[model samples]
Target chain A: MMSDNSDIDKYYDVVVVGAGPAGIGVGILLQKLGINHIILEKTSIGESFRKWPIETRFISPSFTGNFFKMPDLNAITPDTSPAFTLLTEHPTGEDYVEYLENLAKYYDLPIKTEVCVDTVQKKADSFVLTTNKGEYKSTYVIWAAGEYQYPKTNAFEGTHLCTHYSEVDSFSDLEGDEHIVIGAYESGFDAMVSLIRARKVVTLLDDGDYLNLVKSDSSYSLAPFTRDRIEYVADLFDYYTETKVTSVEFVNDTYLVKTANGQTFTSPQKPINCTGFASSLTLVKESFEFKNDYPLLNDFDESTKTSNLFLVGPQVKHKNALFCFIYKYRQRFAIVAEKIAKRMKVPSQAIEKAIQGYKDNNFYLTDLSCCDDECTC
Target chain B: MMSDNSDIDKYYDVVVVGAGPAGIGVGILLQKLGINHIILEKTSIGESFRKWPIETRFISPSFTGNFFKMPDLNAITPDTSPAFTLLTEHPTGEDYVEYLENLAKYYDLPIKTEVCVDTVQKKADSFVLTTNKGEYKSTYVIWAAGEYQYPKTNAFEGTHLCTHYSEVDSFSDLEGDEHIVIGAYESGFDAMVSLIRARKVVTLLDDGDYLNLVKSDSSYSLAPFTRDRIEYVADLFDYYTETKVTSVEFVNDTYLVKTANGQTFTSPQKPINCTGFASSLTLVKESFEFKNDYPLLNDFDESTKTSNLFLVGPQVKHKNALFCFIYKYRQRFAIVAEKIAKRMKVPSQAIEKAIQGYKDNNFYLTDLSCCDDECTC
Candidate 1:
């Protein structure tokens, strides 16, 4: 059910921001717990996913292993699989948006589209969410606003002069025969591959030796899907590892890229910046304490400084564990819901029954001790 | 340890046949339970995986989700991942062999190579396994000899006039510009894709409309990985759906393929047969009851006709469950080991402690009701 500004309810037990995988994931749990909550989407469901570059796809392959309790890697919930719904392994942005829309409809999630929450202020008893639609009062706030829509555009001196990887509609449609791409991460490689398939020559400037770096954690290393794609086009592109771009300068219809190691490369077109994304926490930074740019939260994922404010999604971090992927962040949904429900004094049996499936399928992870181990094989 | 013919053990508590994924998976669990067992192999460890055609790769993608309890799809054990060890999503035959070899070495599994078990006869309270090297006696036997090495060459009339898909060293090395691929499942599509990549023309004959058949279970339909690969070369092949090949005949130095639809196709070289494989159960058909070509087993996957005899790996089946993939069959490893361990009177505390990790990671699936549900989203 979608609500407009005129029909907006002033109070809700909990107000969830964003309607991407994270918000929808936790919202479903709250609904199952019989909590009075509403998910507020700034535009529509999966807007960030809908905005991905036309040629870009999920690096993690999706398989319908839900029956075996492994579920699809990109599925936001235990029972639903993106691969089974979309019938594709690497879903494109549009395809994923369709999946998100289907989940939102099938679960009958209460989401108010076009309701952008501008500021969240906590009063003595509750949190007040000031949105474009109307003011909403809630006992708790869950910050699930994802980070992809907000790209880190000011990473370098003249980064603004180059096209942000997120801004490009499609790499193949770019007007260039030869291109220079800065920040050789997943996004950078995706752009390179798309361009190469378009028969364009590319010079990729990698900030680090990520292509050769292998980590047990998928959050820190290249996905095997990306590595497989690179094998076919490895000979078509020029990759420079350990090369950090210092700045970009434009002079007389030509763009110059300078690196820290004292190398200059010239291109006739704007370089694509694939550095990274800034957390949406910037929107509500004051609500929680911070350490090293990440919000500090309690074991329940609630804001330490705020009484009832909770956090979920990719921005979640604990020590060295980075819960940036759907598979990682989805585990914390039940934890947050259980804590909030207990505080609300919901029936213990009901809470247990609601979370039983999550626990059975390894979705409710309370122990972080095993997260640091490397694969011995 | 690789045992030679001269040092063959004459008796054991449990004797596992065939050192493939199923053999290795069950062996590790038995070792953890402190059971006296030895895995016997006719040739070498991972011999079936090593014999896969050079162009064939695992259709299922591998990812290291061990921390989240969604271990790699191709991993036989919860603690190991093929993707993490080999750094590839879709491991080739040789790459998978390396992973299996690593597991065999890491677990120190007791395996004797070059010992062919030609026959098995049930005696009082024991079973005698007649092998090429010598005679062996055991209280129990686990059949893990996989199906890839046993091609179903007699599926259709005059099949000997065609080359089995497994016999090809490399699809690219075939000596023909035009080829007829006589099966349109995974192997058929795989052959067509490889031939198309090699710049050869292919005519694919599918027994059913498998290309359009979408089943909730992967065992009945094409995988998403194969679907994605087909997108690139969908227009490059001649696909005939609902066409069942009746026979392959040689006429005037040319191969003629006759189909059920009264259509005949001709090629200079022999047609490639990808009709699939016969179960290794054929090796011990008399020892077990058969229903629909699958062995009948009790709740513990033990033979219904023979006492203390168990089954593991792809050959194990329930009402509608097909344990054909590593991820599916690996779940039963603990089940089989636990039954044997309990019969052996291993302490209850030790049994529980040894199988706890498997139970925690979903390596033990005793319920089948949830397996039939389809993805709603």
Candidate 2:
């Protein structure tokens, strides 16, 4: 790979290979501890947030989405009511991205954008990472690039007729009147909703169970604010359910999806594969013995097969279901950051307090209702 | 007294009077628990907040200033930082009032405004509250009129020539070119700053024992903001040494003050009094035995001298060192509210948790750090 000479061969206490939420979160915690580290992003800071569709927003409540030991929303503005200023709403993708940018700027985390890490290998008492920009040696390495970095498509015939969810961030590049979204999960449903909002017919293809945005009691089963957001979107789009699209074909300037229900729906919109991405460790997959496409990890989040390598973020979900959302990611990231900080002997209360605060949110907001306005509980 | 036929004297499970933070807070808790209660306010909801100076803003931090059970700032508006939207670096009083109004509306608190209670006398089974609109008989009564209702001035010779701090909301109100602000406390400092900003030869007069806003560090002190506000008038005024204004005389086209230092400072501007207000409980004081000229309360926030009657807000601090600041009011209000709610058999959590949250100001914005572009925090 071609190399850039910027800060070549610099050694760091910890090196994180992503500038997304997980990486930036770790960087913020580490920065607060005065730890010497660097965040290398192949694209830009909050690249994933930037890639989300215009109508896309955080699926979680804003209260739990803040960075570790960072400023909460109330500190930024005084006129906002605590409920209105803190926890009762969801923000759009563009706004969420702007918020991330503001957070990154506030902490002044040393993030190096456009520095793509090629491989991370273990060395004695440390880890060495080779990137397009330079080689970095660190006592600890966190892989937060996440699954979205690599798009995984099935080995079906005419698979090239579809585009992954990450690639369809902007619909302006595509010329289509209708669409077939392949998946019944959040990504696929989100895409179908987006397409429908654009005034196009969308055939959602999935064999799995369908999760309704609205729960039985009209509340969201996810976060409280998620229901509000889903309702807000429902107000803009109408949706019909349970039609599983089995196959799609591109012919006669149209995309045809044959559902399991013996119905063939033809549309001019291109089929988009919002099946989600797999772990982006293709370059190092051959060198490690993987379990279900994920490297085995010990209790400290250190890879069982390797001493210096570690994993965080959604990639950890490849081994377990945690670390997939903001609330969960908050816990998992803090756990790993604390483990690494302890190993490096960094002195700061940021990581421990963050984890404690995260755990506190689950307890206070969900369990206690005595002070809750609606429950008087 | 003539009563409307609609005035059906009915007994309620609980009756909370005053719809400011204290009243609404109790209402929110009661409503959530399926408890039946009626909150009554003599004026609009949060009348005290509404009556604050138009240029006044919350002195407390946004994060810690919210009612218990309300959401944090981030949960309300994800995209907009709370510090920017709710808590300005220095908020005008109007902002807090608007915020309270929004909170009351959002919670749908059942508050009957414009129903001034003439007297609250305890009956055998319930408390009979005689009001201008009707008679309310309830199991419990909460008195939360707060402290800033009546101005307290020393009866010094010629003291009648000065105006109280509450009346001087802005610097534009004064017509003279010079002034003497009597008091070294927040209000005194506030008045002196405003006068100085208005281009007047302003002198701050007080005993100087308990007037200064508490400061531990000059760098992080609220003094700089206070000082900056006053510097706008620095060209015309000078801060006087610790001097007690023994008397004031309104001479022809000027006001003269006799100080402890035997020095008389004459100014063309009318002397402004920054002496703050005392509790508004004169009418009810006769019913209860006085301790230090104030009503004494037991552990349940119940008057030791009277059963079923509770004292909340600044009245508890009457003739005491507390109740002089917003922080103290917030704490005392929560404690009394919880005690009254529990006394009315309205289920509530331990008072410690409610009081604990009140003491921490991070919940509000002005006392918080915003995750913004230039934040060093």
Candidate 3:
């Protein structure tokens, strides 16, 4: 329905790129702030979540405690819950897409789907976005395009020989009795667990002991959801820690996964590359200065080099605090909105009321230093 | 290890006669207030949770977001989460039991297991309890005995002809291929979903059309977690709505289920009774005033008939509010603790601090009227 719309080439106060949770989140706040904004998407709303592996689920759990002040952790808005909308806790990609689509419809945010933004360039006082649809001019741009859809292809040589974890629709759809899984992060463990459940023999290669490392903060350790599955399937598969896969090659209908320690494993099919995803900022690398592979942002999450240009997704980080999860990054949506609203001169009373709503629910985390506390138990 | 304690024979200020999440929750607050309390469990701590059907999981989702004032809904304490402790959102009965056990140990709660309290007699400003192990005396009694273990047998005649949902360890352990499930609540739908997952044809008999009814409060409606699974399995099973089971008869090696509307279903195996659980207040029916099979309590959850006797579990219903969930029942734990502390003459500063913690996290829900609002979208 959105593909037929010719509104992609328009002028707006802010143009939010990508229609995932992050994009829709900012759009909702933008709507509340009464900002004339439009969300541009390459496909449809939450296309990345729709493209997630069918068996993959959010590590975060959601509960319908919106009225009680405990909104769903994965919810972009305060009153919504993926658990309530999709009726599941650990929502699959499709479940999440439904949630995003519902949020977009509920708020009636202006979003143009199937409009890909190929380039973003700051010209004078506006960001001239060059897209397949046309050139879009906006006073400010919120780069909310998430990272899950963009797989890290350059992690190893001959990477095309293996099936990226993000590419597989479902593990059940794969026709293989024995397979090799490269990388031992959450995705790697997820694929291994899925394969093990389907009565398949798996060999997992890990560069570190992520399974044994237990950290109170989710940013540093394996999620409890992954830990639970690993406990059940740990012994079912062969695991080699400290073994990093350096390259992969397909020869004679067999894929050879070569590791850094001069070890090679053979799989009947292509090895699953669960090495995780790359930053979506790779599309606009010239806009912001990189601080250790992460964007340099001000307190408002706007690019330091390019003022009025903001980033509101998982690629955001401040020192040691990793704002990669939905719960963490969703905090900045209100903050980013407030900053833009203040600059746009939206009434101070309205801005304060809108921002306070987020703060009241403990969703606004301005201080990143306090998040590193270890569990007392 | 607490079974070896000789303190079982001693007197106490409060005897919380249950070591599940409720008892542990009250115990933690009591410990903080320096109150003298001992948790008495009929079996081990969280035995009811341990007895739940293995395939059945918590309808509430658990997330570890305690520091930011959004504690896990399933957590008894502020800092703990079933997700972090058990590593799952919808933890199975065993997983929940482990979380409860961990809470008991972490807080060093004084709990006596395998000591069933048979009867209670108020004697001279004190309650004398006759247990299987010994007689115990206490000034106050908190009945934290949960309801899941006690299945309602007399809901229909010949109920013994069916298998209670809680009796089976897991659905996979069920030997029969064809089964008739009586009662279509959460437990009934849970059995149906599990049976369908296991490729077994199931016939679920419900007294009402609970599937289509959507309520804002989870206590009155089917949880989103259950709803999600029901969506996938609703078509797979034969669901008979508004069909109340009147009797179950076993003849010719076939179990026959008779409903109120002259409908009878037969299964080769015994019918599984998913007819929910009964309150554990049967032991103290003489203590509280009953209003249509419900206990009447004061503002502090103390019995109106007996001043010192209090209720702090799922059975505590007030007006239109049903405190049947961990999040709801957990709110009143502090209220009960505060009332008990004031009576025990504990330091007001300590009591206020202990209770304030619950309120700070929005765990102290003093008003029940606000819970009735349905979702607009």
Best by lDDT: 1
Error of 2 at A228 (Å): 6.1
Write candidate 2's Cα lDDT for B320-369 as tens digits.
23333332334344445565556656534544444444333222222112
Best of the candidates, TM-score: 1
lDDT of model 3, residue A62: 66
Q: How many backbone clashes does candidate 1 have?
A: 0
Give the alpha carbon lDDT tens digit for every residue of A273-364 in model 3.
98989999989889999989999999889999999999988899987777888888888899899999989999999987777768766578
lDDT by residue (tens digit), candidate 1, A1-377: 66546446567889999999999999999999999899999999999989998988998888988776778889877888888888899899999999988988888999989888999999998888888767899999999999999989777889889998889998888997999999888888888999898899999999899899887788888888888888989899999999999999999999999999999999999998999888888889899899998999999999988988999999999888889888889999999999989989999999998998788777888987778877889
Each candidate: what lDDT? 0.89, 0.56, 0.84
Q: Which one wins by TM-score: 1 or 2? A: 1
What is the TM-score of candidate 1? 0.96
Better of 2 and 3 by DockQ: 3
Q: Which scores greater on TM-score, model 2 or model 3?
A: 3
Best by DockQ: 1
Q: Say which docking band candidate 1 falls in.
A: medium
i-RMSD per candidate, Å: 1.1, 13.9, 2.5
- What's the interface RMS deviation of candidate 2? 13.9
Given candidate 1, what's the lDDT at residue A22?
93
